[model samples]
Target: MDDRLSGYPDPDFSLGTLARMGSSRLVTKAHSLLVTDARVWPAPDERLGDTVSILIVDGVIEQIGAGLQAPDDVPRLSAEGRVVTAGFWNCHVHFTGREWSSAATAPAESLQHALDDMLLSHGFTTVLDLSSNPRTTFALMRRIATGELRGPEILTAATGLTPWRGMPFYVKADVPWVLRWLMPAPATSIGARLTVAAQIRGGAKLTKLFTGSYVRPDQVKPMRLPVARAAVAAAHRRGSRVFAHPSNRPGTEVAVEAGVDALAHVPDETEGTETLLRQAAERGIRLVPTLHMFASTVTTDDGYLAPIRAALGGFIRAGGRVLFGTDVGYMADRETRGEYEAMRASGMSTADILRSLTTEPAEFLGRADTGSVAVGNRGDLTVLQTRDDPSPADLANIQATIRAGRAIFLRDSPSKHTADAP
Candidate 1:
């Protein structure tokens, strides 16, 4: 029997009907309408366009020419003086059923629902879930896919694949042990393949491998590499990509040689030379950078954060692609909104930052249809009420977050209008 239904009640609410009702916000005559008088960040490499009218229809854009007009029945939002861009994607995020570790032991369905609420409320309409037990994450994702729940489109990896010592030691043994219970008995040696199969079978879009160890207080250098070429090759055969969490030179070199697809975070403790950057570029591997997480983990010393920023700048200059990844909700001890602020403090330009949070991740995920505003794209978007212009602070304000054309999150919006569960 499927253990998934071992403990359940006839659900009090029909998620399908609720989701449909929530979607009605998008079912307007404005479906085929024009959004005029707004500053449009239309595409990568294009500066902000002058006040323009974007014609949208059936959740896709029909026209973006100047001076477009709205149809008679179509509702015309006074987009005047608002900054409009594509919906944001957090390439490196972890979604789970519990809050701040202190809350729950076993995964809770309500926890999943609440997380979906928070994510949509925060304007993250798409996320690549890098943390969580595969079963729990996918169970929630399947609901969203079936239109039974309103949440971001989810792309997930298996659980965090780390060697015994490299794994997070802080979590009580119960966490890893529960995951271990669900894993195969022959998993020790061939665990990567098993892990990959579990996630792929569960509909994961990618895989995560921890090829490095946590920073040890006494040790001068912390190094480890878990998954190897054979395992990565297996994932490739399964038509999925692997992202390696490599925080040291040896670990990074090994992951690159093994042909992993992305680096979850650039090593913050060490400065990467041009040689390594070139190798990564040649491999066509993208970097998530995840400067926010790095900054939070390490106390600032002279030049500690400097190299991170410089390395990112150099990578972009060297024609390397970058996707914005916040690594949010893994340990939500701190507020997640500060991620955007941290990036700005690191000297990233506003346009580049927005691209990382929006277009680039969409392209990386192969979900080009929902990321940008254009003809035939999904009507997922964000509207920011900026003060002066687009500043990092304004970006974090999150005036309104739209998922599938419905306002799931809005600053000062009515209580019932918001999706945040708490």
Candidate 2:
């Protein structure tokens, strides 16, 4: 293993080793035992696996597959009939925390806590906080890493880059003024790019930009291609990926041309052309549909989402990468709420939805060691209460959230069991 990635202890230092180290207190087990017969998704070939035991040891997956006896000293959880998968990732999010007036400028500490609570409660083990003042964002992330806060893994950009006047105003009250603050002056964008470089210098895993116009969704004034290119190039040079927010066809085209690693959202009202999607596929770019947020807000009145949905379906059919995400601002009641709904509404299959929420986004975020329930992945699992077709209400039914190998969210609600089970 490369020295940089060598920090994790040897796998042999498994649960048994930790117990011997007097650190057994750090290890925990799943709350309720689930002994499911088998769980498969995405037609089973897209990295889904067969029956697995999925032992959790110190927040990491210690072992997988059946018949591995839990040590007599350790507690056992038999989750028969309950499917286990990696926690979800919301790749596109805005951190305004929970306050109404000071949300945009909320203290990073407060926002990180609330955001962590929301994501963990919703079963998202990882989140790429798309837009934030990168300095503060990284500080919060540092806190999470140091156990100063409790939350999912946070990946963030220093500040989103866009022309000084065209940024979106998502925060409540005086949002327009906040736009003025977020817009990229040549100096500001340069400073922001430097901030991004600093983040890379300081160990940021990714970067973000508002490459396309946010002024008016339809009247797309794409960011200057050279400027867009520069931001992405600089980030890429630093071993950090860049994500762009583009909300129109022209803007999407610009993002693709600029070679941004990911798009925070595809064009609204305008469905992507096959050519565009194909080009994006060829470039190995990723798309965060943020379908739920769009479905709930922007596409609500005009019915503009049908084409977006169809476009996304085409993209999926074309084997383009898609990640699950919801654009959330603090204090919003429905933050991170519409992923499953939008997937169902868009006619995505259960398997596809599961992959989008799990493996797909995890892979995109460069977290190959997470997302799947496997031998060495992080033991972050979300166990829903049922195997039946979930209703909209089921969105709230996260029976348990296992972080690392420990149960973090265990629901006391009744479960309606499915027929196909252990």
Candidate 3:
């Protein structure tokens, strides 16, 4: 976050009037949080078979074993034999929906509903919000960072950059002409570079480029090579990752040649994309297939989806890294079962999926303190109940979401949103 910024410009941005959203808040912020009787899956393949206790002090795990103790006044969560792992990360999402337009001053309950519907109930403790009103995004970041809201750790990009004169046709159609100006499509390399630098200075942690954009329902436009390269260079210099929304083969090619760090979505049009995808994999470029997004928003026909799914499988087979994400705010349906089923159908095993959700993102984003459960790591964990053996859907059975030892989501009491004590 931009440290120099004091607070939101909106004088009414925060009224500090939030009612606790749920009655299931088992812990209040105490600089320490304890989870008892948890079956810990510290990593994809490493699971502690027996129930154990996790003791967190000052938002860091201090101990993980039996009979750990804390002060009687400390907060506690009885995991009750549920599974616990590193907190889940949803790498692609948006906060542009109408419900979030007033995030800054809205009652915490109202904002919490949007979060639970889209993210929290699914066990996401961290998310990358690709595009949204920057003001709203910043306000949200401020609220979360200050513990004014109970939600995920959010990283966002500025208004995404597109090809010269190119804006997603679907978006243009839905919005009025004047609003189009807010959607940037710089024509010059210098302009693109400067835009990116400014966004980063304004608190954006990632750069989103529409290397391949749908300028029309029937046409896809790819950003110019020099412009794409310049933007990537600018972001890399700032230590921020560049994510691209490639609409087709040409877009994928630009993404690879220009050195984007990740593909936010698999290019939906697969006719001429395989070779470039292979090249992207060879370059160590990460992919968030978002397979279900195509099914949910475009079409569910096997004819339309089989090849896209095949592309993901091929990428994995080629050793490309995968990040688990559902295009939640954009796709609108919050259920994650279909996404898991689609990835599995594309040949990712349970462990593979787990890595996408946990370790893969942690490694790609260079967040060593997160992505795993350890004594010295951040106390961010997702605890879920499962049957004898866990399945993809079972992963969604969230018991609670803890970030830095504070409870953000409690499935048993989904309506709860307790602001952390300062």
lDDT of 1 by residue, 286-375 (tens): 888887676675655536877877776666777777778877755353344566766776566777778888887777667768767776
Candidate rank order under TM-score: 3, 1, 2
RMSD of each: 7.0, 10.2, 6.3
Name the lDDT value of residue 159 in candidate 1. 61
The lDDT of model 2 is 0.58
User: What are the runs in model 2 whose C-alpha is more than 4 Å off?
Assistant: 1-52, 71-80, 99-117, 170-184, 187-195, 216-219, 271-274, 330-337, 388-396, 413-422
What's the TM for model 1? Answer: 0.76
Against the true structure, what is each candidate's TM-score? 0.76, 0.75, 0.90
The lDDT per prediction is: 0.60, 0.58, 0.80
TM-score of 2: 0.75
Error of 3 at 299 (Å): 0.6
lDDT of 1 at 101: 28
- Shift in Å, residue 212, candidate 2: 1.5
- The 10 consecutive residues of candidate 1 with the worst lDDT sum are 4-13
